[model samples]
Target: MMGGKGNSVFSLSPNPNHLCISMEDGSQSSEQLVVDDDDDDLPPIDDTPDLDIDLEEEEEEETRRDEKCFMAPPAPGMEFDSYDDAYSFYNSYARALGFAIRVKSSWTKRNSKEKRGAVLCCNCQGFKLLKDASSRRKDTRTGCQAMIRLRLIQFDRWKVDQVYLHHNHSFDPHRAHKKSSSAATKTTLPQPPLHVQVRTIRLYRTLSLHTPPTHPLFQSSRRLELRGGFRALQDFFFQIQLTSPNFLYLMDLADDGCLRNVFWIDARARAAYSHFGDLLLFDTTCLSNAYDLPLVAFVGINHHGDTILLGCGLVADQSFDTYVWLFRAWLTCMLGRPPQTFITQQCKAMRTAVSEVFPRAHHRLSLTHVLHNIFHSVVQLQDSDLFRMALNRVVYGCLKVEEFEIAWEEMIIRFGLTNNETIQHMFQDRELWAPVYLKDTFLAGALTFPLGNVAAPFIFSGYVHENTSLREFLEGYESFLDQKYTREALCDSESLKSIPELKTTHPYESQMAKVFTMQIFRRFQDEVSAMSSCFGVTQVHSNGSASSYVVKEREGEKVRDFEVIYETSAAAQVRCFCVCGGFSFNGYQCRHVLLLLSHNGLQEVPPQYILQRWRKDVKRLYVAEFGSGRVDIMNPDQWYEHLHRRAMQVVEQGMRSKEHCRAAWEAFKECANKVQFVTEKPS
Candidate 1:
């Protein structure tokens, strides 16, 4: 028997004197196969079991040929209970041998109540590379007629009926058995160790800070691509959605079928925004990611005077339409109640979007961004230091519009920047930037203390410089959020530890110390301490139900005063007009009002004065699930306001002494749960 082409034999010749044995009734006959040729290497006929062997010499030679050539079993004809089993057996054998096998044809008759089926065949080694890169290599079979066929057996079982063992090309079993870098072998990528994954997560975050998302590092980085590309990153989003009920993700595709924009916000962030969103800070200065898309963050000041990241968006452009679309999407998520005040860089697109989406909202420019421009404007001046100091004093010290006008004119004249384009532009947008014009707005002086400059919730300009893929940027975003949460937690812990001693005789101050967080309590303490310096001169109004008082603050260095109007109603709510606009901007009662309240016969802080965002338990987001969609218990801002009212009533009645309404608190909570359950249930 001569082997064909590279020791690959096609047939084995039978000996002339060899006896042909056949099976009868599914059982082999007890017949002996006689060896024809005088081949001493062949096993004796009587030694062989009762089996079909046309020629002993040929059979022995076949076995020797396989061993000599080191050929693995070629796609064995094995019995299987189903097509899947047959494929598994054949593929496993083929894999063990070098080279690949694929199905050429298959048939199935399952609908006819017959268990007849087969699937994929050997396409692995059939295709050849084309001369041209563009040319198709659809069929380049090696004419190796090594095929396996399966037929239906009893009880839905499939039995291998035919398996040919002829190949035109040779194979190396050892090399094929080992894993290969070919795409065919990589059906599933191996997962890295948990520790390695954690370390990679850190590396990904660090690299993201220095490179844009479209950089080569993000595309080819092994550590970042271990999760199997963009699909894996999408899976992460799905996982978040599955685990978190309040998480929302929205994406829009461009005309070329690419991602145009995306916005995501978790439940906690949304809840925080709903409570502290009255004074919003929108910043679009951070342009990051591979697409060079701007990172827009909506930030708000919490009760602690700390910045709270509300939500983030990535847009293709800073156009009015794009900003409008982004704001509308955010509004939909936040239940359509816009923030009362918006602090942002003086971008025309951003300004237009705010005016359209939140017509009632007070759109103010960020003082930080304004000062940035002022510095740039003064950079070319002869005496820049004098100009900067003059600018700061003009912007910071003015408490009235008239004072601001005088200071602004003097600074520009003194510094010879009267014709400056930057200053002129700022003057044109004076109401948007100057605190004097925006003193009535409840922004909590956020313009002075910009929230946009604080801890960013997602990928911001400071954290991303390398070009990165969308998937990698998103993964890095998760890590960034984790870091922010860790920082916030640490800050909260440190603030709690450093809570000042309640060194005041006012009962309301002591009550506030218990209800408010340490940071807010300390802040309110200043007002309590200053109450001693404020002298009230009350005058009865014609209405008779209300009285106006001149609260004059006569400190040794600073002399300031405010008008406090006390409504002589059972509710006991006081209104104050102060230069600082602390109550209007910060959501907390100003010092003058606090002094007036303390001076009055009031026993506790008015419920209306206590903002929920300052409460110790502001993190508890009240989410309610309903059918396919869900709604926040505080979906409508009024709901939160109503809850605050009830809470204040409870606190007012409970804080009569050290022993308050413990039972009443429990009852109120229980009633709230029951009401929520009923309201949330489908009608």
Candidate 2:
């Protein structure tokens, strides 16, 4: 018999008794066979299994081929006892066909978070997620449509709802089988070992400072595609959870199983947001990684007037859908509390998303944007800077909503902008973006962006930059948090010990200094200094108890009129409000109201005027579920603060006697040496 692959044919040689088997390789072999009468037919060989053949191996190969029959794609009615069983069935099919599969996504019922169905697809089915220049895997995703859909059926059974087998790229059995790339990575707990775990960690440490962390498969000098690309990302998240269990992350996946957006907030970030979440500022263009994924930072102002990152997300694109996902995820992470007010970071998508997700949320554009648009987007204005400054004054110093409306109309007419679409649009949306119109709400200084000379969030300007990889971005984010938290800790210490000189003889200054933070005290001092701008006050009308005054105030090169109402109806309460809306806009007393109080001989700032949000000794409500700081990963500030108090106590007791002092110093040195030795010791 001729042993070869493919079809074979038999032929007779010159010798009638011999039979020849011709192979496709052009080889001829013969075996003796009995010919029938008249030489018309040959007898078949005796039916027998060859003793030399491995029947078990043959059976296994046959079984594998049978499983590969599913490559025609599983039938829609195919049923399984559980979702895992369903996944395993299709995974086996993919294994036999030589490709990878992953959970594309899971669908949940409307108004619920419970997953109802699962969509699994080829690993390389979706468009490339990251835009890394050196990524070899960029072309791996050929938009393969090979996938399976699993639906939860009656009696808790999972059934195949759909199957697609067409592949855009050629696949073979040798392709790595990544059946459990991301879902199987549950190393959130401390596991002793993974494949080459120690070696990978050592390599990561050596290269991480200079280069971005990459998959172990891509650690070579030459770029290589990741095997189970998202496995590493998921592992990274778990590793952080190992240190900080309160690290909240939500990922949005494409239909083809690609990660589209990711949002994260740590325990500390949650605590900060609870205090500062009233006003959120998000900028999508803030920072980017090596892959060019847009880093969206949700930031807020701390009591120190420093910008703090409240939450962060990496979006595939700044499209409407992506922003909607970001907003929803952040809202969920913050426990469904929408920000009272927000200023978007010059992206229209953000604004649109905020409106869609949090429709009730009051959104406003920064004064900077309105001015910038007039100066750049509009060109008809002859004195753009002059007009901008004039508009800025009216918005800032105007006492009533009517005053702003009149001033805006006057500017349009003066600039011959009656037909200008820009001015007309601004007028149409005045109630939406105008600060004077939004004075009744609490903003907590949301309006002071570029105007306040506030510094940018530390993460964007200092920690991360262009060309940062996912690994590097995370590391930089951690470093960013560390630096900011450290600064705040230090500032807290300084504020506790340092005292500011009195800017005024009024007792209100002393009261503010005692409760307000040093930064806020300076803001209060600015308002105190502006009291001289109050020209005079004339009584408008008095009902023997309620009195109103029309006051003149100096603003730049002009004098503006403001009305302040003082109601002394009840001796227990002296109700007052200035139409300037400074207190409501900025959470502090306006200069106009302060001027009136000063003239009335009132010495102390009202208790309501001092906001708890800006109080120097504001208490923090920490949700331990948001992470209580595991023993291994204690907060550095807290550690230092507690240790410092103990050390100071030791120093105080030791100073009582020379012998005690020597003993304390010696013990400290010995403890330090031991700690140093333990740190230097290797695992």
C-alpha lDDT values of all predictions = 0.54, 0.57
For residue 19, model 1's alpha carbon misses the true position, in angstroms, by 78
**TM-score between model 1 and native:** 0.54
Q: How far is 79's C-alpha from truth in model 1 (Å)?
A: 50
lDDT of 1 at 512: 81
* TM-scores for the candidates: 0.54, 0.58
Measured by lDDT, the strongest candidate is: 2
The C-alpha stretches of model 1 lying farther than 4 A from their native spots are: 1-239, 288-293, 450-473, 486-500, 532-548, 554-558, 563-572, 600-603, 617-619, 622-683
Q: What is candidate 2's lDDT per residue for 1-683, written digit by digit as tens? A: 00000011011111111011111111112212221121112111111111121223565554343222212234343445556556555554565556666667666555555445777777677675455546664356677877766655554556555566678887644442332333235433232222211111010012223333453311222111222233345456556655653456654433222234556676566667878777877764443222343567888878776778787776556555566667876775576779888776444555666777788777876555555555664555568777778777777756567878888788778867789766676667677667778876666766664432223233366554554555566656567677887887676666666898987776777888888888778888888878878868788888888889877888789888888988774654666788877787778898888888777777887676777788888745333122222322122323432353356456655764699899999989998998887754351
